[model samples]
Target: MPETNLPASKTSFVKGFDKWNIAVASGFYNQKIDYMIEEKKQELDEKNRKYIYKMLTFSLLIAFILFAISLYVSTYLEKYFLKYRKKIYKEVEKNKKKDILLAHQSKMVAMGEMMENIAHQWRQPLSIITTCASGMQLNKQLGLLT
Candidate 1:
């Protein structure tokens, strides 16, 4: 067998690296992976959008059902218990008024009693003072004061 020699290609670092088929293949594979990842991301975004819309729709439906039920209950209450509720309120009001009237009457009676007591007290003291003054004047006129 005859010996054969091949010359090595001498190039700069940047050019040599770029010119290799491995680099080209790596770039192509990297680009393919990026594209695939972007496709999956788009699909996930679409799924998320659908899920959000469905959830929103479900929530709105539940809200509507609750509102309708509340309205129905309100009607039923108004139809059934309206008269009783008003009757209870009127009874309470009547009792309250009666209590107020009784309190007022009691206060007036107490005031009258207090006024009578005050008049009686003042009259007794005034009478005693007048009697003492008259006795003093009589003694003075009779020369008993000296």
Candidate 2:
């Protein structure tokens, strides 16, 4: 056996140390990436919730406004209808009064015509009776009524 002197090298140990350091850095990077992803998810969820709330509020406001408009319109129409009905009642009453007046005037005209006819029928008989009474009186005075 020949004895030869050689320098001690730490290449293997240095290589193993480098490998360990690389593994640790990789693990830290993976952890940081996971944390950033979780933050982004939470932010997206908050934005979605705000948008839904705003939409709901807007929809409710529109519905309330429509209901108020309908109520006002219905009340206005009812008031107008009542006024028209009152006017119609007044007109009907006026017509009825006019009809009664016309009936009374017609009855008066008919009565006047009937009275004139009765007077015309009695005139001739009354004149005949008067002539007979005067003749009798004259004969009695001359003594020829025996």
Candidate 3:
């Protein structure tokens, strides 16, 4: 028989004993060893199944916790972003109003400069007309315009 198929013996061998004599005296059987091996394999399989179930349950619980945390963080960030965006919008509106006010002031300044330029342009012509009218009045008084 091959070494792997040899039966396990409960009895220990005596020193200097003949191997064939011990085999007969020990009364060990192959069928009993095979039965014990099969029972041990089933016991180990059961233990492995219980360990796998525990690991699966623990993994699912951790996954659920992580999912909840992600949801909370995403919601918090969304609200914060909205608040920041509103603040920025208000700032932009305020700057737009300031720009409009500055544009109006600039237009008023330009209009005042235009009115000054128009008055300067008319001054010389009005002075010339006044001098000619005064000379005509003086000539009429002297009777030089028959």
Q: In terms of TM-score, which candidate is strongest?
A: 3
Report backbone clashes per prediction.
0, 0, 0
- RMSD for each model, in Å, please? 15.5, 14.7, 6.5
For candidate 2, write residues 22-140 as lDDT tens digits: 42222224444566999999999899899899899999999999999999999999999999999999999999999999899889888888888777778677777877888888888
Q: Is candidate 2 or candidate 3 better by TM-score?
A: 3
- How displaced is residue 74 in candidate 1, in Å? 1.8
lDDT of 1: 0.82
Model 2 residue 114 CA deviation in Å: 2.5
Per-candidate TM-scores read 0.41, 0.49, 0.66
Candidate 2 matches the true fold with a TM-score of 0.49
Per-residue lDDT of candidate 3, residues 1-146 (tens digit): 24567545553343444765543233345666788999999999999999999999999999999999999999999999999999999999999999999999999999999998999889778888888888888989998777
lDDT of model 3 at residue 114?
96
Model 3 misplacement above 4 A: 1-28, 127-146
Where in model 2 is the C-alpha error above 4 Å? Answer: 1-52, 124-146
- By the lDDT metric, which is better: model 1 or model 2? 1
